[model samples]
Target: MFHIETEIRLVGPSMKTIKVSSRIECAMICSNDNCCSSSYDTILEHCSFFRDCCPSKEFSKESQTLTKISGFNPPPKDCSELPAESCSGVYVIQPENRPSMTVFCEMSIDNGGWTVRNDYLHFILRQRSYQVRFDLEDFTGNTSYAVYSTMYVGDESDNYKLKLTGYNETAGNGMSNFGGSSLSGMMFSTRNRDNDIDERSCAISRKGAWWYQSCAAANINGVYSQKYSNSAVYWRSWREKNGQKKTMMMTKPKP
Candidate 1:
């Protein structure tokens, strides 16, 4: 239903995978009409490409590492009170394969004309990680990628306080001060900078996971977490060369 957590695994410059950990069917109601808010007893498994988060970025057999996948620049939920200063503004991605979610349609200058390259993207916030993916694509020239963004949630490994202060959400580069707690840490982001769009409106969200503590307890809120799964791979793509349908990437976008 929703993604509680998403772990990104970049196997190659053009190939990466996303392993999501979330719940499945939502529990329904009782005789009283008010359904029990308890979570589903079982979890689900899903595997997809992080690049699949965007469609326009994928290339056909003629694929090349025009741009590499960033290690993953997690982002803080825009609504979160975390200030820009206190966030990990500078994404410290592996230089070779830095995360490049924000990409412009670089139509071949000589053969460039009427190319609307877009990677309709989305984010999944979980207790530990924020996963991203693209769902649309149509391109003429080759595509380029950019590190769209990264955000943070919480990690108890350091301290009970949810104050890591800026950019500490980017994993490995996350937090050193707080070592080894078990707080739910998540960073969600997207390539779509246009927040005006309906889809971009949900840069951060939940699945079906609940708080380990009580809703009234510290770091414990009675809100529904996102339910993630292996089937999270919902994407589409098409490519045109010389004004003819050259190829159709029948797969998800690769990071």
Candidate 2:
């Protein structure tokens, strides 16, 4: 799925580099990009992306300025060319408990309470989160998307974000292959790993209440759950509980 290589440059067919928040974010950008094969960067966030080549540790690097780079295998350009499929899956909506549901990758959303316009999808979670299983190629070729709209950032410190990824394994990078599939970031999985819904999937959290907690004790105070690194999937979609809302964006790449 992904390989974390350090202090090396991947020289090959190149694409233009743009400013990103962190090295992990940069790596993820490359991972989602079918045209990008590897990523290289330093603490300054000066990153380079390659298309035709994979990660390599054999490169000239000044001994003192040692830095690590993360790489992932991006899909082919034609991956998303497929049309949308029908939204076929078991959807359970209960007003009593947290409002949750499951969706599949090949399923269409026209009548599944999901709205699509232009290139973005929109939906609402009155009191909780949801498990969205759509191929990454369809949404936006990347794991992260711009916040088109949000209900409220109740707690300033809380993170209001969404994740397009696979199962949560407490290991390197906090992600692993789900259902024996190598597709890591775009699978639609649920908070309840043991649920009847698919476990090999991705998730979106507009505002969450620390649902899938790795912590032993409940966090009474609305605080961001335990996290490892900026790029760690465990903390990627973590959200505050007070004021929860659901709204996401998907940007279509230029032809």
Candidate 3:
């Protein structure tokens, strides 16, 4: 039997941690199936997940930081000994009102069709978009790797370039608790037009924090290592292009 636990946390604009009562609720599933797939709904009230899910709130003039949740577990006391990656960066925003992020990669022919799975983590704030690039030398037979990527802009505006910043990679040994396989980034953010140039705005320069987990990577770890975060993951063994492989994050299919 497989059990999946979920947790959500919300931080105040002032960086204050807010506690909220929340639990995972099952919307639909199939049980005792007789072959035909049927629809059903169930509520799991005993879900012991407790955290601050900073529910949707109006943007206030007060400048504050969002709590960056790095992983399913809490961070270690001493980060100096861990091999962490920069989890945030200033990305060129493809202004839109959808996905808010995307992943990019090149097609591969060495392996069969491959699949890429991603998770949107809200460590600091939900990322406005997720754009990952993969090498497609094998699939496209190109002399160089081309970027196949997607873009999920937020609802803020159809014309605004977002600047993503903070980035933290987990420890290499697989003991990253407040860590998982998820990458994090900034959500939809724009200029505070209400404020004057002399006023303090964009108070926090740090990128919205969070993490990303590849569904493909987590599946491979089962056979290789014991420690979770540091162990080998699905990214190492994705098929070249026989199945569910992502070429890029474009508005439509590539030419």
Best by lDDT: 2
Give candidate 1 misplaced runs (Cα > 4 Å).
1-19, 22-45, 50-53, 57-255
Compare candidates 1 and 3 on TM-score and give the better one. 3
Tens digits of per-residue lDDT, candidate 3, 1-255, equal: 011111222122221212221110110111111111111111222211112323233432221111112232223211111123311111112212333232211112222111122222221113223332233212222322223233332333422222322222321211111234222222332233321111322211211111112211212212232222322221332332122211221122212
Q: lDDT scores for all predictions? A: 0.21, 0.28, 0.22
Model 2 is weakest, by summed lDDT over 10 consecutive residues, at 63-72
- Number of backbone clashes in candidate 3: 64
| TM-score pick, better of 1 and 2 | 2
lDDT of 2 at 125: 27
Clashing residue pairs in all predictions, respectively, total: 40, 12, 64
Model 1, 158-252: lDDT tens digits are 22222222222211221111233322332322223212112422222211122221110111111222222211211111111112111111111
RMSD of each: 21.5, 17.4, 22.1
Question: What ranking of all candidate models by TM-score puts the best one first?
Answer: 2, 3, 1
Q: Where is model 3 more than 4 Å wrong at Cα?
A: 1-72, 75-131, 139-144, 147-151, 155-255
Model 3 / residue 140 / CA error / Å? 8.2
